[model samples]
Target: MASAFIGSSVKTTKGPSVAGTLAETVAAVSRWGNQPSSEDVEEMIRDSALARHAALVKYLENKLAQAKGKLKKVEKALAKVQENLEPTELPTDLETISDEERFLFRKIGLSMKPYLFLGRRGVFDGTIENMHLHWKYRELVKLIVKRKNIAQVKHIAISLEAESGGVLVSVDKTTQGYAIIVYRGKNYMCPQALRPGNLLTRRQALARSVELQRYEALKHHITDLQERIELVTSELEEMEAGKKFEVHKALYSKFDDGSIPNEDEEGEEEPFSEVEDPKSEEGKLEGQSMIPADCNLRYQAL
Candidate 1:
């Protein structure tokens, strides 16, 4: 009976231990099951992806807006360039000049000797009207083109012929300047209005020239800005793809080479020291340093 009882006690203890282990395993399995399901994890991943996609789309939309603005500015600048380049004069039916007619014009034009000067404001309204006034007195007009490039002088000569409705007879290069002899055409009829409506004033011409230069500079600047923007976009794309890109080395290397102004260094003030009154004895002795060494010492002693 004693042996049977001891065996039964051992069995009971072993059974409980086995049961406890199984229960612990069941609780562990339950805890594991309580974790997120694969479908839930996939859904979370999808939501995260959608959020990232939305952010990228927003960034792209902003970039597109900026590009549109820049494009509009570029178009306006180009239109201005075109407008400035076009001749602001009426189109004339120009007939070809014969050699004899040209010779006679040069000879008579040299004799008349009335001159007109063209300055920086090339072929403005004032110049065209002056040419007509000269033509009213004489059949031929002598135009003196000064302070202009050879190409510009040629262009001006052609423009003069067209705008003034005169036949270009001779273009003589002189030490003084280019002598453009133009003949009032064979059927030259004085216009009711001397100055064309489209011709710009001297000031207007100058303003247009300045604007054209500014537009050209702005065009180059815009191109450089676009290039930089493209580089930045490429770098951003690389970063988004978990790739390393050296933006500093590529775009900021020039800035790095230049001396960067340190705010601390620039903001630093010199140490303040109080100055002694010039009327004081010590101040007077210090100020008398140019005097003889003995005199200075004696004054200090005094």
Candidate 2:
């Protein structure tokens, strides 16, 4: 008799499950009796297994093709991102550079033309960019990069000679911000993300130090000159005021004090004067002496 459930296994060569009748069972039994030999069944099973493997291999091949296509697309996207991250193409015309570009170059230095290129845009506008900001700005490397435009740097470091004190500014093309590595002590540093580091190398530190020293010297000199000018101005004003006062005093003494030679007492022993001479202490100025310091007088018997 046929099993109640026939063709239940869809994975088998048969289709969906079906109910079997007695007549069907009898026919199945007859076919089963006339079925192929055991050797033939074994061969068929082996062939079926091989066919399944072939189908699976076909499916895997299709999947692999799809994966390859997807990988190609991913590679394109990655390439685009990398290209954007890379430095901008150097403008061909540095000599005829734009006003903005020239300004940026001048701000850094005139010699830093080689490394200066119209870089990939930042959050702000402007084409010119600092190449070393992507890594480090070493004085020696800076010179080289200015000429060669290609140099490898390991760390975004800034070193000062004798004593290590300087700022390290690093700007990687990948990151929006640069790092500021300030040397606190002998072997410690805080790699803080903020303003650009002062310089990436010792040579820059030396140059910067010299510049600051010169600036300080100039400032001091200016201050000294200002002081001297003020001192001289003060002396001049005092002298002018004293001269005006002395002239006024001489005029007043002549008119108001009546300290003129008298015609009636032409040979008078005592000089005629409305104001009396006052006694004076040594090194002290007496008030209303009624006679000028340079005045000459001749006295005779009264």
Best by TM-score: 1
Ten residues in a row with the worst lDDT in model 1?
Answer: 293-302
Report every candidate's CA lDDT.
0.57, 0.31
Tens-place lDDT per residue, model 2, 7-124, is: 4533454665445867778878887786688879755655554343344334434434543554465455434433322222222221133445433432342222233221111111
TM-score of 2: 0.23
lDDT of 2 at 1: 28
lDDT of 1 by residue, 1-302 (tens): 99998887873333445456878888888877767888797556555543544454454445445545655765675465445343634343446666566666666654444577665556777888998898887788877666446656656776777678777676665544666777787788999888876667777776555545445554564465455446445644655575543433433433221332233542343443433212111111112111121111110100
Clashes of each: 0, 4
Model 1, runs deviating above 4 Å:
1-93, 110-112, 213-302
- Report the CA-based lDDT of candidate 2 relative to the real structure: 0.31
**lDDT over C-alpha atoms for residue 96 of model 1:** 60
Ten residues in sequence with the least summed lDDT for candidate 2 = 119-128
